[model samples]
Target: MCSFKLRPSKLSRYFCENLKIMQFKNTAEFAKKLDAQDKLASYKDEFIFPVINEKEVIYFTGNSLGLQPKRSQKYVNEIMNDWGGLAVEGHFKAEKPWWDYHERLAAPLAKVVGAKPEEVTVMNTLTVNLHLLMVSFYRPSAKRFKIICEEKAFPSDQYMLASQVRFHGFNPEEAIVEVKKRDGENHWHLEDILKTIEEVGDELALVLIGGVNYYNGQVFDIRTITEAGQKQGAFVGWDLAHAAGNIKLQLHNWGVDFAAWCSYKYMNSGPGNASGIFVNEKYLDRKDIPRFEGWWGTKKETRFLMEPEFEPMPNAEAWQISNAPVLSMAPYLASLSLFDEVNMDLLIEKSKLLTAYLEFVLHEIDVELGETTIFEIITPKDRGCQLSVFLHGQGKALFDYLMKNGVITDWREPNVIRLAPTPFYNSFEEMYRFGQILKQGILEN
Candidate 1:
């Protein structure tokens, strides 16, 4: 029963049309049949899953932290071996010289984020990078000092925005404007966001929102929103923490001023892995722009001279405040290599089908339970790999039961569970199995 107007993208239209006509059966055989036909089926063997009670758990928390790729060990060992043998010399002598190691990720990561190679660079962690990017994009004046964001944003973002406003001697209450969802609604409307931007008009300094809402899995219209913000003479940036590798992005084409995303979630790097950033090509090599400078952000040709003047790199790397964390970046490079092999388009196609199948399975389980639907899929049609479900007439005991039964999911406050079936490793058979387990948990409790 999930239905919404498809976005203008051809992939979205194709996905929506196929989803409407696709029939699903609540059987293991049917699940296996679908998996057998999946073009990305073999990619599942590339990841490592945890086992509990002698069975591999059905992992559905990729939105929180993706499973590790097997190749991550090899990548990590390369760095370790070089450091053990060559020490300081390893900076220049390693197979992938440590000094320029992060440069290898730019091209592939660019493809995933739909940016030019020079516009993207791997850098510090998520919130840290956001703070750094804000140093440049959030320049506020007395007339245009207000920032706009979504209501109920991630806690880290709330803290970051508040601190930024306070640092500039502005009160958070007066400087920050949050666009709220409709009464009793889980998702945001595109028109409401656009209207807010219009109303904010001349006073808006910046518009920064999570491209994909972490809590509800809603995918906002980035291109439209970015244009609206810019029209009002405000800079636009995105926190792509959940959207980076989960959906198709065109930061460059979208004319986004800046963006930052962690690789730990959909990118499948490691826990708190290095973050990647995108700065529009227009901002590159601009000496007039404001940013915090560091040695690593300098041009490589003159970096060895240790000059007194801060000569920034002619690309997004200028935002980097410190030398690359080689250890943390190793796993990220490994994950990006896998991304290069599969490409975002193929993964997205599979994701559409896989997520639709999961939705169908949830509906089947609800039908089996009773006339009153106990499960409400709060996530709207404009979503990526995640579905946030509100469990009506359910409690934490049901979540605990599922966890004990080997279905790993993320539980939110009140009564909600976030399920993300990543295209890389999640299978249709697992989706079918999860539905069975979910039914058992509810009935037993």
Candidate 2:
């Protein structure tokens, strides 16, 4: 197994070249051929690809960061030209004005999340928005001061919750309840989650959960969980960084109090791009919620008035603490335009087939090999494009081998590889090819 170097073996090269030609010949020729007939195949050409060794390497890391759209360069260039030509006046004189630039993005993002125009705001990064939303919604009373979250939440969120508790003079270990999956289970049972809520009813103040878990790729039942929390009189919010563009969401109709997500993943925005937040319409009229405010959060019409008093704009905009970053949002606009070409329904349909195809191929290889190859998928079947696979202890070695061979999936710490075939740009062929390479890696090792 250690004999397998980082260099692509002769076997790998032969496999890649033959697979390329065999990619579109027949349905029986694995799923790669199916990509040739895919209705959304044209979408792949819309994005820019980085050339490594003069080849467009297979990219399965979209769940972490999506490939840049070809249009993004043009979009950012336009912003650059505007800023250079108009200087400070670019606030209004430019084509996509700096002042209302963020608003232009809100419509497309709202369309993606199934929210009303006023309910969504493109603002801070995921964890920051989560903290900001908590400032307004996580109002704990003397008796109800506990917060609920997943046992294995993203670390930044854990830190955010800990700090939020300390800010209120409470110990996180005592006041925050982490809902855990049973031993040997990949996901938390809905009944058990509800039971936890029931047991902590009066003490729970907020229930914050990841829409799609970062580690296992489990798409949690947001509506069900939020309903349970609301029944217990707890405020419900979601961290949608993994689910926003990867899965369909109805934050407003689901009756969630708030949600936040970054645009960089399946949304295809660039690295560290601006994120979005959602606030239900029911809170639109409630001005009493304690909030962190700035001039940007003030009413747009009188924003220039510069009054010392902060009168926040209605809905999600009121949550903004600063002006939108112009350059950072240009990529979001470029990515969102691609979404306009293909809506969630079509993309999701393709995604289901793609993921199911991957599962079928992996299982087929496992059966043929007649050995325990040490790869077990840990994500739930109901998950989106991402599939988290657990390797039997040799995780880092396998991950490095896959990267050297250009099968670019992301590895989480300890032992998990996350492979996401983004519906908008990824193809059936890519999934099939990855399975083939992965199978070869296992056998060779």
Candidate 3:
């Protein structure tokens, strides 16, 4: 379980010495060799990838919803047994008390998002947590009354921002600043984003951008963006729904004021699992911050006293609006335990190599077909497991064909196919096969 920690010089040397010999190829034999050399290869068996027609489906939709962990059932059964035996006493007396269950998740989740244990907490769904954090962070005064966000942010985020502005009696159109890519381009350039931040410097009350652009799969420079927004005297937050568990983050180190992400994506938690939130430790004791709080957020010592005066916990847990749903959280624990063992440093390195292989295979398809007619990868070089491929034409038919052939990729509106090769469960062999299928698909279409 030791992580591969190498300095830049040594890492380069290691790559040249070890990885150069393992050159990526479009053949199945090369895929096998890569898989054989993969230290994380054994991890693929930990999850239950979907099977269809007596064959294992090429499940590449982890960016949408990750496959289930085998230990999830065991984790849930423990809670179920506690409910059946201890009943109400399970809150205090169970093996892992339901009352303090969420606390157990905080430390491991902190590692995932690169935050202090006191800065992160697992609680409500992503949108709910986003809105809750906004109630505290989106404090717009007379001069700073605008929010700068991405134009192509998730639909729920767009709706949430609009409603938040409207709730404050501000016109959504006037108070919300949306930054879009240049015409004819799918990815956002860093210079353009920095320019926009400068343009809205004075009026920007908040800057809430997706850590990774979901549609185009572009990873943003969080530290630089946060610094830029802060220089403009604006609170900086992140919607990490598409970035969490897939990419390495430093929410606290980067001075990200707050962030929220769903656990079901690359986290490998069950569907609709509890979301995690990070509130920087600098704001931990800011009693003036207006958060939507509840009993669960009160200090543990006096929480049972119910004295009517809310004494909030001196950590990110103070933002909790209600007691966590233990059932929904159990499976997350099972998955988090695995992350703790394997660690993000290793996972992130493996992810880069695996996705690079996918990209290589895709290019090979273009060459094999002797045409640029297949599809174009819109995802940038710096990305996580997911790659967004823009289909040339009649994408629905090709998508349907892929689905029927047991390739489970995600299709967005219009003509984008998102292929996510989860490092935890997906294999190099699958990437090679997908390239072959995609070439066949393009030719048939």
lDDT of each: 0.92, 0.81, 0.86
Candidate 1 lDDT by residue in tens digits, 1-445: 2353322121122235444444567789988998998989999999999998899899999999999999999999999999999999989999999998989999999999999999999988999999999999999999899999999899999999999999998999999999999999999999999999999999999999999999999999999999999999999999999999999999999999999999999999999889999999999998999999899999989988989998999999998878889999999999999999999988988898888878878877887777897989999989999999999999999999999999999999999999999999999999999999999999999
Per-model TM-score versus the true fold: 0.96, 0.92, 0.95
Worst 10-residue lDDT window for candidate 2 reads 1-10
Off by over 4 Å in 2: 1-33
What ranges in model 1 sit over 4 Å off?
A: 1-21
By lDDT, the best candidate is: 1
- Look at candidate 1 and give me any clashing residue pairs: none
**How many clashing residue pairs are found in candidate 3?**
0
Q: Could you give candidate 2's per-residue lDDT for residues 64-183 as a string of tens digits?
A: 899999999998999899988999999989998898888887888888898998999898788888889899888877899999999979999999999999998898998999999999
Candidate 1 local accuracy as lDDT? 0.92
Q: What lDDT is obtained when candidate 3 is compared to the true structure?
A: 0.86
Local error of candidate 2 at residue 395 (angstroms) = 3.8
Candidate 1's TM-score = 0.96
